[model samples]
Structure formats: C-alpha cells, structure tokens
Target: MTPLTLQTPEEHPFAQFVRILGKGKRGARALTREEAREAMGMLLDGRVEDTQLGAFLMLLRHKEESPEELAGFTEALRERLRAPALAVDIDWPSYAGKKRHLPWFLLAAKCLAASGLKVFMHGGGAHTAGRLYTEQLLGPLGIPLCRDWAQAEHALANGGLAFMPLGDWAPALQRMIDLRNTLGLRSPIHSLARILNPLGARLGLQSIFHPGYQAVHREASQLLGDTAIVIKGDGGEIEANPDSPCHLYGTAAGLNWDEEWPALAAQRHVKPATLEPEQLLEVWRGEAEDSYGEKAVLATLALALRGLGRAREAAFAEAAALWQGRDRAAL
Candidate 1:
C-alpha cells in the first residue's frame, strides 16, 4: 500500500485520470479500458492527494468523465470495500442531496423497503449547499450512522439500511469534497462518489444531474458487465418524478444491457403536485397520500431488485408496500 505521505502525482494511479481530465479536450489518447481501471485503482489505494485529487476532479467535471472512466472508477472503488452478501440490494448513487426543500432520497429508501428491498444510502456528512442532507433525513427515520467499516458491513447484512458516510469511510477522498467550495468548481469526485458502490451489488440504482450521464450510465453498465438500473433522478437524487417520465438505462458487460423499460410506464404519467416538507413527510413517513412520496421510493428499490427490465411498476409498488409497513410498525 502506498503511504499517503509518500504518494506523488506520477506514482499515483489517478495521474493518468488527471491527465485525461486536465487536458480539457486536448489530452492525447482518451483513456482506454485498462488505463481507466488503473486510475480507479489509484483512488482505492489512497495515492491521490488533495491538490491532485482536486485538479482531476475539476478537470473531469469540466470535461465530464467518459463512460469508460466512470465504469473503471466504479470498479476500483467497489473492489476496495466489502461486497454485499445479497445479489439484490438498493444502493442509490445520489449526487444532489441539498435540494431547496428536502432531499427525498430517504423517502425513496422507505418506498423500496416497503417493497421488501434493502437499501444502502451513502453520502457526505456536510456539503456547502446549506441544506440538510441524507444524514438529517435518515435521523427522522430511525436509521443510525455507522462509523467503521465492520459496522457498515454488518448493517448491510443484518439491517436493511446502512449509511456509508464518505468522511468516515474514505477520508482522503472526502478531503477532495471540500475543494468544491474553495474553487467553486465541480470535480470528478462528485460524479465518482455517486457511482461508488461498496457492496458491489450486481443490481443498483444511480442518479445524475448532467443529461450526459444518460449515455455514460448506459456505457458504464455495459463495460463493467454489471446489471444496474440508471435514472435521471429528480434533482440528481434517486427519486422518481410525478411530473415526467424519467427515462431508464440498463448496462452490463461494458455495454448497455437490454433496456426493456417502456418509453412510458405501462400507464399514463400523472401530475405529481408540488410538495413541501410537511406535505411530503407523512408520505415520506408513509402516513399521507403516497402517490409520489411512496411511489418514487418504491421505483428505486424495485429497480434494484427486478434487474434490467422486470415488472417495473409492480416492483415499485411492492417496494412502497414494504416501507409503508415499516412506517406503520413504528407507529
């Protein structure tokens, strides 16, 4: 293992990734499959420092990581952590957490649970957007944060919910998260974190703000040969929308897997009313009109379970019912 103190840019695996990202359309040789994997390896071993980490992050954010790079980085990061025992686990890679009202990814989690799905929601402890994040949302739902690797793994196995706080699990990479504020620029780490899957679950859900991600996610699933469900989640988190049909992507074997999801749901898209924290919480807590709050969550969890293109709406409904039951049990 390269000691964090001895690591330098040239020796770091992230070096090539920094190059591809830094050149900003000028870098020679867009990283090939193997090279992309090597760069991801650097991330896992802690060879990248704050400045280089920041630089590569920004460069990729500017250029947007290639689908190949995204998959490679995901492979490297997931390999470092303990793979989950189950093939089915809801691991949503949510990039946008601090939304204006409340981030509803946790509600997504509850919906999936109601459908009898297990979820692993991960995020940074704090971000500059000045709104509470997943950590705060989970607190109201009785999910406790895990501080160590063993505890996190145990949570995934024994409990349906676990929080992989980036600050606690990967501090070096976490340091780069703060650079977003100092430079006021987004970076590759932002995308990478949302793609990071500790459990290495074959089926997972991810969301992104950049529309470019639709293509990238499709490519990533194919390159890695992992069956994953991808969504342009509402505001970059893995929550469904009542306003529109969020297109889905399937990926496996370094190629986009068969995307059997409908251009539209089996049914028509209904208008989800604009919601606030109070109106949404009961739905989030599974206590109110659940069409949006409940359905959104279930969709994510069901996608995690049903593989590429199985029973989309029904799986979503199942997830909602599972979490709704959990919510009632607490009462």
Candidate 2:
C-alpha cells in the first residue's frame, strides 16, 4: 500500500493571482480592487513566491495598472506603513530621475519647506544609469535624509521637510523597484509609490513620463480620497518645463478638473550639456544666475501651490514671491 501510494503537488496560494493575469488574451483581465489589495498584501507580506512575483509584475507592466488597481495597491501599502501622525501638507514623490536637466523640483520643495509647509519627500535609489536621482542630491542640497519614521518625524516637525529613501519605510516595494535591472523593465511599483501619500498629506504631487498615466493617477487619487495633481513633468519628475505649456489633471473637494498653464518662455530652452549638482547650490546661494532653472523651479512651485488649493494666477504669483523671499543662506 505504501509503495503504491501517489501524491499530487499542492498549488500555491499566490498562484491564483498570476493565473488571473496570465489566463490568455481573452480570458485574462485586470485584477479587481479587492483582488489587487489581496495580491499586494500577499507580496508585501512575503507570502508570494519569487517566480510568481516576477510573472505578476511583468503581466501588470504589459497591460499597465488601472486606477482601481493603483488605488488598491496604495491601500495595501498604507496598511503596512509605520508612518507617524504628522501634519504633512505636501507629499512629493521623486522616482523618475532627471536626464535633461537638474532637478529644479528639489528647489521647489525646499522653497515650500522654507515657507513653513511640512513637505514629505520620498524616493528610491539610482537603480538606472545616467539619471540624477533625488537621494543622490539630497545631501548636496542640505535636505535631511531620514532613514526611519522617527527621524522623518523629527525632520518634518523641526525643518518642515524630510526626504526618506523607499527602502527605509517599504523594503518590499524597494526590492520590487530594484528588480528593474533583473526584469529589464520598470514595474507598476513606480506608479504605485507615487500616490502613496503615506502620512495622509493634504496634497499629493505626482509626475508621469508615459502618456495616459496622468489620468490614471488623477482618478486613483480620487478613489483614494486624496487631493493630488498629475502632470507630464520635466523628465518625468514633478518639475514644470518652462519651455512648454503644462496641463494639470487633479481632484479637489471631491471634484476633478483640468487646467492649462501657458509656457513661461517663448522659445524652448536647450537642455544643458551636462548636469551639475553644485549649480543647485550656486543658484540657491545667490552666487549664480540661471534663467531657465529659476523659471522651472517657479513653475513647479506654482503647480504644487495649485494642488494645495491656490488659484492659477495667485499660485504663480505666490510661487515667485516665495522664490524671491527665500533665505539665500538657508541652504
């Protein structure tokens, strides 16, 4: 009897999610919100196998994540975050590193922080080549790099700004991001991380490089009951390109709207031959002049202001004032 016994391998619990997405062309469809939440929770909890994780991520990359999926993934992440009860006004996520220009949006965040707004900025490491990441420049910019929730709390409570690496708070998400090299393509974690707003900030600022993702982010923000702005920003960062008209998609007070911001320059500015991190310091220290850089900073600042409930004209004006009045020696 023992020699004649036979057994079948038991199916993995996480296999169902992979099957949901890889069920052939017609049979496959997007995961529902509840399914997304369950799958993300399983991944974040380390319940998913490595093979299953890779396949699931690639499946999502092929179809792109929907608003419901994004919202659900964000909800799962928020449930596991060790974030403090901080009065953060702005949630600034920097994932797409700068390629053509210096990160002018970093200055925009600094200006907001200097003006007494609690700005919580988070980003992953430089996983890709030839791009300037936020964490790389935070030290040079004099922004506090928080490694944990306690440090982040202290930094925001005292200096009104904090930059935390993704790995510190969400190691699973960071691990997924690091898979970019192994997978040879970016996964949906990049998009999911953008709208995290982990501390429940009043305003979330998101940037997308791919066309059509702006609407996804805006709608996902609405689903999450978060006030947020989405833009096709400079180099896929939340920095406005002063050389072109910027279109904004966002939700506020339970209403969605769109606005077009006119170009700040008549002629498109040429990208710098090379990016110099020190230039950020030079411009902030009042030791150098960069017309394009300054305009980009101001325009990005205006975008954040608008997301925070300021009107168009007033937001631009206030952004300029904030720049002009910034303590030159603060950095």
Candidate 3:
C-alpha cells in the first residue's frame, strides 16, 4: 500500500448553527428567523452530525425558542411535507399524551367528523409512560388510522376523519421526538411538531402543558398564515376540561386574539376507573351518563367549530344543539 497523506477535513456545514446558539453568553443569542429556517433545513436534510444535532436541540430547549425561531423551524418542516391530495378542514395535533385523564379530545375530533368537518389528526405515542395516546383509541372509535399520505386520503374519504402518526409524515422529526427518552428532557421538536400543520388546513388545533408556549404557538401560527386555536387543554391534550377554567389563544383571518372560557363542571371531578376507549364511545352514543365528559365533548367541539369559522356569538349554542342531535348509530 502506498503511504497516505493526512489532510485536514473541513468543518461540517451544520457546526456553525450549533455554535451560534452555544457560544458564550456574551456572544450567544437566539437565531434570527432566516437562521432558524436555514438550520432546520440543514437538519432535515441530514447534514448535521449527531453530536451537533443534540447540542443544537438541547440549546433550544434550554433557551425556549423565540417566536421567530418557532416560525422559521415550522416553515422549514412544512415545506418538506408531502402535500395531501385533499385539504382538511381542521389540523388537530395531539403530541402531548394524556397523563392525568383519558384522551377526551379523541371524542371531540370524532364529534367534529360526524358533523361533516374533515378532521386530520396527527400524533405520536409511547415517548412517555402512564399516558393515553390518541392513536390507541382510534380503532375502537371506528376512526381510521392512516399510515401514509395515500391512506390518509382514503381514510378521509371513508370517514371524514384521519389520524396520522408523526412518524408516518415526518420520520426525521419522529427520530428527534424519540430523543426524549435518551435526553431525559423534552425538546423543541415537540413544539415544532404541534405547529407543523403539514396539510395547510383552514383551522389548526393545539394544546400545551406549559403556559408560556401558548403565545409561541399563536405567533408562529400567524407567521405560517394559519388560522389556529391553542389552548391549555385538559391534561394538555387539546380537550376542554369541564372541571376547570380554559385559557385559549387563536388567530382568525390574520387577526390574533385570546379568550377565557369558564369551567363547565364546577363540582369535584374524578377520572374513570378503567380509562378504557369504550367509555368515549359510550358517552358519544348516549348510552353512558358522564355529565362531565359530555360537557367536555360539547365545549371542546364548540371551540373547534368557532375556530373553523362559525359565528362566535352562536357557536356554543350551535355546538350544544349539534351534540344533542348527533346520530347515535354513527358510534
């Protein structure tokens, strides 16, 4: 073998993005909108080394992303998404699995679907334990789960509702989402996924556990030119809790606003013993009397209908009327 000459390798194109955030306090700062867009693009393109990727993600988590950074990162991911064949009326993202209660939001989506709104719901599960995931409840509820864009379209055509797991739409982001188990902390991927809205739906629904992320999502949605509603949902999973007050943020026709909804159930609330999927169906079919669960379903549906452009003045009454008239046979 011939003697080999040693050569200095050029730095990775993605290193500077990490360094920009990790530099000393005097020099380090959040990325501009453009830098964030560029960084996310490089990341999704698989140009960053594993070490650099981890560093960048951790830095973002520690700093909590700015509105600009969120907007840029979301825009980058949105650009890479394979567009669906058809438009959905609502983009419901359920990344935060329910820890304290069952996913009441699943029923909310089904309710919307039954009412003729094509709801496209997406999420991932098993990142954390002792939580109920949206995907797990889809089958029993008779809602179809779409594994790819084609199936998503099929499901929509069949039932007017489709649940797409994040891994199916954005495997790269799913890989990042899985890092939670290794990093022992939540990353910005969680926030970015909620705002993805890959299908460019007319209305987007999101929920956040941390109160501060409400405005981050609101501002980012405005940047994406999406009409959305972000709420402090029950267990942070996009379902209104009849037992507690609800805080909401949203954008309508490009105008941003916030609203406060009082609790529908004022008495003490207790979770069910089984937390089974059947309970959701039971409530929807009018076979079980869960006053709280029913109230939560209607209230959540009302918020969603208003977000989808019903007159705000009559949305709640219309929602209650709709709920009262739902075809039990659909269950």
Candidate 4:
C-alpha cells in the first residue's frame, strides 16, 4: 500500500500559534513550516473545500502569522516549484511590467546584465485569473517565458535573466491564487507567493499591493537577512515607485517602509497617458526595441542608475549612454 500524504488543514496547525490561543482540544500536535507547506499543497491540490480552506487561511492571518508560518508557506511554494541554482551572480527575481508606462523591469535586466550584474525575472506568463500579469509583457524584448526550472536556470546563466510562470512552476500556489475570487481578498498564499525567495537569492525585486504588508514582508526578508528591492508597483510592477523614488530595503532586520520617500527622481507623470491596452502594449513594444526614441528613452536609461536618493536620477543619461557603444551590446 502507498503511504498517504495527509491534508494540512485536516491535520495539525498552530504550534507557534498555541502560545496565545492555548493548547487545543484536538490532541497535542503541531505543524512545521514544511507541514504548513504540505497542507497548502493539499488545499491547492483540490483536497480541501472552500469553507475549510477559508478557515485555515483566515485563522493564520487573523491570529498574527509567525515566522514559522511564513517559512512553511514559502516551503510549500518551493516544494511546488523547486528552486533552481544559477551560475550567474545575482540573488533575486523581478516581476515584469509597469502600470502607467515603463517596462523598467526589462530595462533594468538588460542594462544590469550589460554592466555585469545578474537578474532573475519570474512570472511572465498570462494570469489564469483576471489580474494583469507580467510574463506577457516581456515578449517585446524577445524574453521568452521559461516553462520549467531547467529552462529558467539556463536562461539566467546564459541570458542573465529568467522567467518562472506561476501556473507552470507552482501549480499548488496557482490553486490558492484561484481562490482569490471566492475569498474576496488576498490570502496567506498570495502574500507568501509574492514574498517568496525560491532561489534563496537575497536582493530580488518585488512589487507589492498594500503598504500594510511592508512589515510582514520586511520581517520575513530580514530573517533571511538578504537585501531586496521591495517596491510598490507602478502598474503592479516589481519596479520602482516612479511617482516616489524611495526604495524599501528589507532584510532579516525589519521594515524600512517608514523611510522618507523622494519625488524628484521620476519624470513628470504623463498623466492619463495610457489606459488603452493597445496603447500600453505599443509603448511596451517600443521601449523593448528602442523604437519610441526620446519619449521612451529614460525607461531603459534608469537601469544603470541604482544609488539611493535623488543623486541616482541625475546619472540616468550617463548610464543610458553606455548601452549605445557597439561593443557593449548583449546578444
């Protein structure tokens, strides 16, 4: 007979949680991070129902999630999509796309790689659900959506870039993502998936939805003690908050969310610039191929400038100037 993989919600949860809530009537058992990951696996695998899943998810969120809980959530994400090691020397993944107008993620990847920096970009595939996703946007740059770990590693090592589609790499998490409609709010899985460090790479890039998540994500990353660019997405992007030039630095220390942000770094917002998907797509394509000329010049130019404060903005032109040299072009 085959050994059974038990469902997490059906099993034990809240060992760390027990201190506040006290021991349960349901026998002395506790779930580890891996166990929590496994339980999430079950939920994503369709082994659990709507009510049961909601209870488990909300319980953790309402009760105040522990580091262990967060770790378990990431573990499940890793289990579903195993981390791929890269020969390249960068720790992190950048989500693609910009809200109003900037494929700054692509610009960042290209110039950083040219300047001898490595970057891993994950999730370039179309959203199975309604949310606007990044995978499809990088197509303009000929950056293919990596379908598996093998492809991802190869791409990062050779191209200094990688794309991990959620649907393909982490199906269990995908299942949890599907529940967003029924639950009517983001769950632990959504938050966990966003903050995931599958490569153990410290310094990856992230675009977040809520300012409130700053502390939770900051604490988690600080525990890992690796620096990462945690930015509020301009268009749900993992790029900088173009409107505000402040970058949130989170490691295994604490939240830097309170730092004073700057506004002078970004160019004037071309407000009401683009809501048309067609126009947006056209701009993205133009930026990738350098077709928009001066209007879209700074998008890629900002890639080479990565210092703190307004000083970084001044050097943008000089950085963009480097990519024009004949010998510097990347294949």
Scored by TM-score, the top model is 2
lDDT assessment of candidate 1: 0.62
Candidate achieving higher lDDT, 3 or 4: 3
Q: Estimate each model's TM-score.
A: 0.77, 0.98, 0.94, 0.67
The clash count for each model shown is: 19, 0, 0, 11
Candidate 3 ranges with C-alpha deviation above 4 Å: 1-9
Kindly list the per-residue Cα lDDT of model 1 for residues 1-331, writing each as its tens digit: 9766765545654565667656645554456667767876775577777677666666666666787787777776666665435444666654466453346557556545444556776786566555556776566665658787667666655656777688776665676676777879766777677666666655667777677776676677666666676777767776655445567676655446443443224454454344355555666444577444455555555655566345767766656556556555442
Worst 10 residues of 2 by lDDT: 1-10
For model 4 the local lDDT of residue 61 reads 54
lDDT of 4 at 26: 50
Best by lDDT: 2
Q: What is the C-alpha RMSD of each candidate to the true structure, in Å?
A: 6.6, 1.1, 2.5, 7.4
Ordering by lDDT: 2, 3, 1, 4
Model 3, global lDDT: 0.84
Residue pairs with backbone atoms closer than 3 Å in model 3 (clashes): none
lDDT of 2 by residue, 1-331 (tens): 5678679999999998898899999999999999999999999999988999999999999988999999999999999987778899999999989999999899999999999999999998898899999989888788999999999999998989999999999999999999999999999998889999999999999999789999999999999999999999998899999999999998987789999889999898888999999999999989999989999999999999999889999999999999999999887
In candidate 2, residue 222 scores what lDDT? 96
Hey, what RMSD does candidate 1 come out at?
6.6
Per residue, candidate 3 scores C-alpha lDDT tens digits across 160-266 of: 89988998888888999899988889889988888888888889898887879898889888887889999888876888888888887989777898888888876
